[model samples]
Structures are given as structure tokens and as C-alpha cells.
Target chain A: MARVVVDVMLKPEILDPQGQAVQRALPRLGFEGIADVRQGKRFELEVEGPVDDAALARIHEMAETFLANTVIEDFEVKVETSEGPK
Target chain B: MTARPSPTATLNGGPTGRWNVRIGVVTFPGTLDDRDTQRAVRIAGAEAVPLWHRDKDLKQVDAVVLPGGFSYGDYLRAGAISRFSPLMETIIDQAKAGMPVLGICNGFQVLTESHLLPGAMLRNNHLHFICRDQKLRVESTSTAWTADYTAGQEISIPLKNIDGRYVADERTLDLLEAEGRVAFRYLDGNPNGSLRDIAGITNEAGNVVGLMPHPEHAVEPLVGTGRTDGLGFFTSILKKLVNA
Candidate 1:
């Protein structure tokens, strides 16, 4: 089995209004315990067989084309394992 | 009656330059939608020129588009570093002189960073990366980039982003509304907690426009969403060129 991890976030310069809103509401919610809140998404994929460079690139392409919007987000892909040929 | 030199000829020396309008689409280090923006311009029957973020010149393109994508990996801010690019200086000057300019998604963030338009984009209310087919009402049609759309015309476009909220001082928001400068408004639910549900806006002269939605992605019917509601933006500029 092969495992892949994807981390998605807004491009650094893109304003993260959602994060700001949450920050603003944190105090109002009587949860002043939070210092800051920046939000993003994470995905984990398990694929079959040994993960090769080509397969990794395909996964990246998929992330770019659909999984993430290159406009506001960037993604990092991590391969956890690639077992021997099935 | 005397005839004026073709706009294309005055801009770029291309063959059949008589009627074709040439537009430049700028690509920053991390730009993601430059290719799609160029394709949209081409499909609209205009020549699309690719411009680099580091380049100081616009290459004499009649109009310009700053496509979406992270620039400089959003290191300092989403568009903060990119706002200092040499191309932005030229674009700012040209846009001030009435050249048409459009900014989409990350491009919109860059514009806000540059202070070309008054406001800033912030994180969404939900604190999540929101992606969906968004409905927007064209709030104003006077802008050179939006002439083909009618005011109040609701159209659908693809929206994908994390930092997509629009914000400004209350007074500034009031002025934008009073002056009818708001270019587009979000319909249905607010995607990113944008103030007053604003999806887009234009400058006073109606030459520069900025919006958080990805219109380029909606220009093609064969692509993911298969909605072409965003093609009007490209066609509108072409019509403006033809009339000019």
C-alpha cells in the first residue's frame, strides 16, 4: 500500500478573510483562549503498489487541476510509503 | 471621412492587426491561471500576449490581465511582494491613463496590495478553502472590461480560494455603494464572508477591475464546470476595442 498526504493553503499574499473572521469571533464566543486561527485543508490518499516519480507527478497534477485552486491555494504532497510490487 | 489607425497596429505590429485586439496576460512566479486567461482571450478572437511579472514593460498590449495564483509563494502576503514587481509599476501607470486592466482571484489580491483599488481581501468566514460555482450579479457595466454585461445581470462563475473575502472601511464601503462602483455582488450564500457580499469592483474611471472569482476558468464549456458565463468579460473588451 502507498500513502500520500496533501496539505492545502491559501497563497501567502491572498487575504484569508475566513481566518480573520474566526479570529474576531473567538473572543466573542467567550473562547479568548485562542491566540490566532488560520484555516486550511488536508487530505490523505492511499494508493496501491509502489509509488514512483511518475505517479507522484500525476497526483500533483491532479491537485493543481482540481484538488486545489492555484489561484489562492498551494499544496504539498508527501508520500508515506510505497510497498513492493503486488 | 477620415479613418484612424487600427488599435492593434498602434499596440502590437502583428499581421491582420487591423481588427484584432491584443491583450497581455501577466504571469507572476506562482501564477496559476495565466494560461487559462490567455486561452480565454484567444477564444474571444483577440491575440493574447504573455507578460512576465519581472518584466517592466507591457509589450504594447492594448489591455492587460493579472491572472490568479500565488506569487512569491505568498511569503509576505498573498500579493504583497508581487505588488512591488516592475510590471505592476507599468500597469499602474498605464491603467491610470485609461488602459483596461482586470484582476482575478490572486490577481485581485495583488491589486488590493498595490492600492490600485481601495480595499483588501482577507480569510473567509468559514476558515476553509471554498470552491464552488458562484453566482454573481453584475452591479455595474460602465467599466471597459465589463461593458458587455448589463447592470444587475446575474451570472455564474467558478470561485475557488481560501482568502477570498473583501473588506474595507465602513465609509469606503458606503462610498462604493453610493457611487455605484461595486462591480459585482455575490448571490445565494456568501462564500468567504465578503463584506456586503461584494464579489467585484472597478475603479472610478472604469478602466481597472478586480474580483476574487476565477472568470477564466468559466470561459470554456468543455472544462470542469462547463459554464461559460465568464466569457462575457473577454468579449466585452473586444467590443470596446472594435468601437474605439
Candidate 2:
């Protein structure tokens, strides 16, 4: 089995008020020198068979069509193989 | 161009008596304003048809209204999940073919997600949910839902939402302004930090309009802010359908 991860984020130009609020709170908690902060979503998908180009491409399509709005967000997909009983 | 009759006059049994305009109101999971929207339609002298989100059929209604609420709990993103619902599939097609579609508040979010209108809504600049009586200026009367309102008319309606800030590419904003497609502009103060203070906008064909304010709530005189300024939306569409 293979694990696929998709991370979706707002475009750099768009304003992220939620992320900004978190960043502001961090300063009050004595966390300093953080240049910037942005919040995004991450999705993990488990596949049943060997991961191939076709499978990766389909996952990318899913991310583009459903996981991410594309208008205000960008996404990236990565593959992580499950290593069991190491 | 002939002078248009007042919506009040038409609602009071104008020349066209007992007009049979059927307007469909859609309800998705968590949709809260469908009943109020139906009432607004009936008050404007049109038949209100209830449409379910999972149903592909539109029931032969002349127009559709996507009312306000946190559909699908506004999961993933506001309106993202609901945009792919069966009802929206038909709504998108009909909207493209010039059938009137009015999206209010969360409905506006759905329209944007469906790509029937441009831009995406973001969280309010202050990161808080705001609810109040909002003043807006009617910027265009060419759309199917704004014909009853004169340009530059200022009216107050109730607005409540967290994701009400409207954002779009600069080029699209310029085009909307150039073509006079901006249907409503925020007045007195910008409620949610929307770009250009835009409260609502219509599509290029003037058949689709999406706004963040709740016009249905303002249609009754004794309830919800006690101003019927929002009744014009229903009356405007009825006038367009009857004349068409």
C-alpha cells in the first residue's frame, strides 16, 4: 500500500485572516522572530496497489478538482510508502 | 425605453393580474433561509417552488434562488461541497442559458464556487462573524433581479456572515466596472472588507446575481429590520419574466 499526501494552501497574494490571527497570538505567547505564517490543509490518501504515474496523476487531478479551489489556492501532492514491521 | 412600474404597484395587483411566475428556492443541508426566500417570492406575486439539493430536476421553475446558510457545514470551504450537488449542476446550466439565478450570502459563496460568477469569498478582515443592517447602493438595473431598482438607489438590508469578503483578479474587477455589471455597492461602511466595496455583482448576461446581504429578510415590513428594500429583487425578476 502507498500513502499519498495533498497539501492545499491559499495563494501568496490572497489575505489569510485566520493565519494572521494565529500569528498575532503567537507574539503574545512570547514566540518571536517568526517572519510570517500561513495556514493550509493537508489530506492523506491510502492506495491499495503499487503507486505508478497514472495513480499519481489521478491524485493530482483529484487535488486540483476537489481538494483545492484553484482560484485562491494552490496544492502539492507527494507519495509516502508505508513501511510496516520494520 | 418605457418607464418601469414600481414593484409596490405590481405587488398591489397591477395591470398584469395573478401573474404565474414560479421561482424555485433551493435547500441544501444546513440551508436556513429557503423558507424566508420562498415567502419573499410569494409576497412578490410569484409561486415559490422548493428544490432539494440532491435532486437533478428543476421542476420547470422559471428561475432559481440559492438562499443563505452554512451548507454542508461549510466544510472544506464555504460552498465548495454544495457546488457539486445535483441541483447546482442544473442551476449552472440554466444560468448559462440565461435563466435568472439569485444567490444570497452563502448562496453567493456557492455561485462563486460553481464558477457561475467570478471571484472567491474570504474570511472577514477582522476574522469575526458580523450581523447588522447594512446599507447598499444599487449600481446596476440591467440584471434580471435588479430591474425594479433604479441605479444609485440606496437601501438597507440585513447582512450576517463570516466569509463575506469578495476577492477577484484586478482585470476582472476592471471589466465588471467597465461593463456596469456591479449590481450593488456597500454604502455607509464596508461590512466585510470586500474589494471595491462591492456588495453584489451580476453576470455578463445579467441573468445571474450573487450578493452577500440577505435581501429576503428585508422583504417584510414588520419583521427583520422593518424595511422592505429587499423586495425589489423578487419583484424585479417577476417583471423580467412576465415581460419576457
Worst 10-residue stretch by lDDT in candidate 2 chain B?
B1-10
- For model 2, residues B143-232, the per-residue Cα lDDT tens digits are 999999998999999999999999998998999999998899999888888999999999999999999999999998999989999999
**Can you give the lDDT of residue B47 in candidate 2?**
85
Error of 1 at B72 (Å): 1.2
Model 2 residue runs over 4 Å out of place are: A84-86, B1-17
User: Per-prediction TM-score of chain B?
Assistant: 0.93, 0.93
The TM-score measured for candidate 2 stands at 0.93
DockQ of each: 0.13, 0.76
What candidate 1 gets wrong by more than 4 Å, as runs, is A1-86, B1-14
* Per-prediction TM-score: 0.73, 0.93
Highest TM-score against the true fold, candidate: 2
